[model samples]
Target: MKINRCIAPLMISVILSVAGCSSSSKEDQVMNANLGAQALYDKARESMANGNFAAAADSLSALDSRFPFGPLSHQVQLDLVYSYYKSGKIDQTLATIDRFIRLNPNHADVDYAFYMRGLTNMEADNNLFQELVGIDTTDRDPSKSKQAFDDFRRLIQQYPDSKYAADARQRMVFIKNRLASYEISIARFYMRREAFIAAANRGRYVLEYYPDSDQLQQALEIMVECYDQLELTELRDNAMKTLKLNFPDSQFIS
Candidate 1:
């Protein structure tokens, strides 16, 4: 009985191992059976031209898996990122971007990947429904916005003269404004709850980190009000003076 029990476990293990190998072999065979690298790339391009991003992604993924180091490898990775992004596969787009950036950091076109990373993260922060409904996202989590901002910042810093640098700078401005606006929203909420310290701190953060934001005036106003509430006369006067100097026509000037 003991011998039989040991043999049974051994046989089961052997069978499982064989099954795993067979599964992997099948996958390899399928990859091999696909069109040649060039043909597959052409197919993906055609699909992309037709606005069939899903089909293009499939073909490009298959090409990438079958020919990881082929002559078209770099182009395949770039195309895969674009197709995945167009297909709304944010995770796949990011994974491919990370892989490309990791493997080809010094490639001439790496800046495009960085730009696309920012664009993807920005897209992830919004949904079609939210756009259609005109929902207020200022109070929503800003983590994705922050990530996008970092991506664009890195692109600008590393590829200052890249073709996409101008657009990246523009997007960075927008992201800073959005982030500052979100902070102001939080500060306003804290003010409503009589959390003067928290409100003033948020305003201070915007002033310190996002001075170029369009919400600078609002942040200064909030800081002044919060400091007044907390009886911080010096801080209130400083904030008020800054607000007045910057925004002479501001309603809060008085």
Candidate 2:
């Protein structure tokens, strides 16, 4: 009877101790999860501030998965987009922006989302005809550049007073110059091949569409050359007159 009583007390103590330990472990796990989430968020912010975008992205991704719909979720989503952009993951950047836009169209930062999408595409431009045309079409697509320009334009149209408006205007100028240069290049190629009509038409198109382009002088000069080659005396004289009127001191005209 005495031994039985002793064994019973010892067994109860052991059982209680085990239960206490398990309870403590469960609490510790909860505390650790909360702390880990906080630590991850802090590390992500630090990495972003330090320009370690890849590390920040990884940390933020962990936080996102662990604490989905948590208090910091929205901020984490935006940070992920910025992180992808800073890390040079252009496609990811675009996709993230699209996702954000689609998810939160009325969010306060929606304009920024659009602006970032435009900026992403603009930065990824390859400036190669073959790459732009996908190797199947010999034609110069310019669609990527056009998409970027249209995006920026949409931001300006919808959010005229946005902080990105000035930047969008600057990007538009760049797009215009790029388009003008492409046209001028095609015109010169035609000129070299003695395709005078094609060359003149291309040059005229540039002059008509991109009057503010830096290539204006070169385009007019090409027109003058093209008309001269075709023996169109009136058109050649007219092109010369226009060239002189626009760029009297241009080296090409002189």
Candidate 3:
């Protein structure tokens, strides 16, 4: 009986040790979910190359979480941003870009983040339905356009020598034109409502801020009409002179 009791205890201890070892090994396997950082990055790259951006985003997100301190971490984050953008996940793209910019202010590719942010905001404001239906959006809210303009402006000012600077400058011009048109639309609305002072102020705002916009002539015309309505003869004459000076063939000139 003594011998059997001693043997039973020994067997139980051996079983517990084996079970403990097995559990430890499984935990290690779960902890090191990935084979290695390089292999996972390669997998993500392959997914991206296959045009499977959702899969690529998933893989890249996993790699980012698993190997945040790895040598390829920056590149991984950039790739993830691209994946999110290509996947049409604008919110995620913007959030990831903001996080990247905040975390890597001095990174060599930080300029890319700014460029992507501008592009994403521009995309967010693009109403495909309105475009297809031929609905004019100039009078609509321009909050996203304003944000995109700010992003591009910051990129151009802060990274003048960046490779994307030229493109940012071009986009800024387009945004300025759009914003000018928006102001003109509001001024016309005010004119229709008989708010001559408000309309003239909006026109002046366009001239002051968007000098090179394509809507310069329209702004001047609005100013002239509004000032005349308000009985401001001097301001009306000044707006007319400027309009004739700039646009010799303006309808308001004759």
How does candidate 2 score on lDDT? 0.83
Error of 2 at 227 (Å): 2.2
Span of ten consecutive residues with least summed lDDT in model 1: 25-34
lDDT of 1 by residue, 44-103 (tens): 899899998987898899899989999999999999999999999999999999999999
Query: Which run of 10 residues does model 2 get worst, by summed lDDT?
Result: 134-143
lDDT, model 1, position 176: 91
* Per-residue alpha-carbon lDDT of candidate 3 for residues 1-254, written as tens digits (9 for 90 to 100): 35587689899999999999889757644544655888777877887999988777877887888889889999999999999999999999998999999999999999999999999999888899999999999998889999999999999899999999999999989989999999999999998899999999999999999999999999999999988888999999999999999999998887
| Backbone-clash count (model 1) | 0
Ordered from best to worst TM-score, the candidate numbers read 1, 3, 2
Best by lDDT: 1
Question: Which candidate has the highest TM-score of all?
Answer: 1
The Cα error of candidate 1 at residue 18, in Å, is 33
Sort all candidates by lDDT, best to worst.
1, 3, 2
Give the TM-score of each candidate. 0.86, 0.72, 0.84
Candidate 2, superposed: residue stretches over 4 Å from native? 1-38, 65-68, 126-142, 251-254
lDDT of each: 0.92, 0.83, 0.90
